[model samples]
Target: MPSNAPASADNWWCDESSEYAFMGFSYEVTACQSPQQLQQDFADIRNTFNGRYIRMYGACDNDGFYDDVVNAAWDNGIGVHALIWFGFDGGNQWQQRRDSLVSTLYSNPKAKFVTRGIQFGSEPLFDGVLSPNDLASQIWDLKGQVKSLGIPVTVSELAYGYQSNGGAQNVLDAQDYLNIHMLPFFDATASTSNDAWPIVQNNLQFFQENGGGKKMYFDENGWPSVTSEGVQANSGAAVADVTNEAGYYQLLEDHCSDLKNNAQGGIGWFAHIYSDSQEPGYGIYDTNGNKKFNFAPRTYC
Candidate 1:
């Protein structure tokens, strides 16, 4: 929590709150949930895990929700990073929404700690929503605008499968910080499989080589429930998922250890809850907010 703490113990990237905290869900932001309810939920989560940060995705039209969540986080001593979802139109509507949100924070300096810089776009490469070059341009422009307001910025959820050259290169060049979500399950194995280790290692190496001096954060990385889709159908078929929760925990511990020792920046996991709707289950906690069967891991470093 202390700003001067060592990066491994509790600095911006490798802090205790970020390394051990979970990214909160965004589905709870629908119109159904009132602002007050959202605040209460934020409080509950803070008390439940003593979380220091919460990741939230924001729609261009949902400025009110953004304001509510930002204020709630500030009141509760929780850091809120808003993922700004932009459409293809490239209109002022999205810009206006962003401006308003940033303006709100600037107007209320007390809430500065509650809100972090905007996440330009999520997984733009995978979604095919924006070309790498165009994405870079947009990110640069957005960062410039936010910086004009004195807000630091980062690109959230960059697709790791893409090579770390060209447009991806441009995005890193354009921003003050770069963030990547390393979902190892996309590799041959979800976690237990040997493929997982190298996949992460290679990605870390690439980021360090290309990210320049800019900080890189592992915004999202975790294993999901094993399913048939997760398995590889190669000459020798291998299980796609690691059913052993302890293996998953150990994988994280080892991975974090390596990340702490190697990566110039920091690393953090995905959600507290893993969803079965997706191929590989990706929740650390069940639907009811309870730690899943094999979710326990030693927190002391």
Candidate 2:
């Protein structure tokens, strides 16, 4: 079948061979999968997606081992944005548990080489898990401990979280560079992927200014291909179809010049996910590891 994007399949493949095509992808560690399976997944992250980095949503499996994940990523020649997973500020156990993993990886020779930085938390303000000041202080303290390891620290939040008055201003102030989410498909103004670029352009300046003039990236950009029932889904006409997903990514390819140049104080982009077979249809690769679209990001249009 043909795609709905402006370009045909033959013209859709971007210059993914460029290291600046995309900074990284978001991935998780599954205990059910064997070490070999995880290794292949990391290989795909580097080779297939041309990702230089990855933000892991998971760390340890049942035996409390995180080395497999760290080693796979590093061995695959991809840097890792290690997660500290601070959900709902209940106590210090979450921090302490992750502390053990960092301590272990700290000794690995690859730690300094492939560990990009430690993402202290993901959308804590959006989830109401921590106050801006609290999360900022936590980022401060984490950087303090991990300085010898030579890892920077940051937190992810929605663009609105950086509101100047009472929002997560401190969180923005604490991060080394801004890591924010700006998903256009969720906006009512976006009827389809073709409509998404305008939304991104309209918001980029606001996001940049509110972000305090630091380097930034849209870490959770995504669009679904379909609904869970295997039918088309719609959010004000942002239809969940493979073609729409292709169209959304087409914009990514067209806009990569800015990222590659690091122009206007931007760093890179990491799409929402690599593969999600369960629901909401945002996976580029399906459960059987088949890529749904013949798409890649280019450094220029």
Task: Provide C-alpha RMSD values for all models, in order.
Answer: 5.9, 9.2
Model 2, residue 249: distance off in Å is: 1.2
Q: Candidates' TM-scores?
A: 0.73, 0.81
Q: Model 2, range 1-301, lDDT digits (tens) per residue?
A: 1212122123322223333446767775533456787679779877876777776664353443456666676568777777776555556656775676567556555565556667776666766667777778988887788777656677766665555337566777787766667677766676888778877776576655666666666666677776665333335566777898878877777777755554343457776677774224777788777888885765233
Error of 1 at 193 (Å): 6.0
Cα distance off (Å), candidate 2, residue 173 = 1.0
lDDT score for residue 281 of model 2: 75
Across 70-119, the per-residue lDDT of candidate 1 in tens digits comes to 66776666776666665445554555666776666655544455655567
Q: Of the candidates shown, which would achieve the greatest lDDT relative to the real structure?
A: 2
The whole-model C-alpha lDDT of candidate 1 against the native structure comes to 0.55
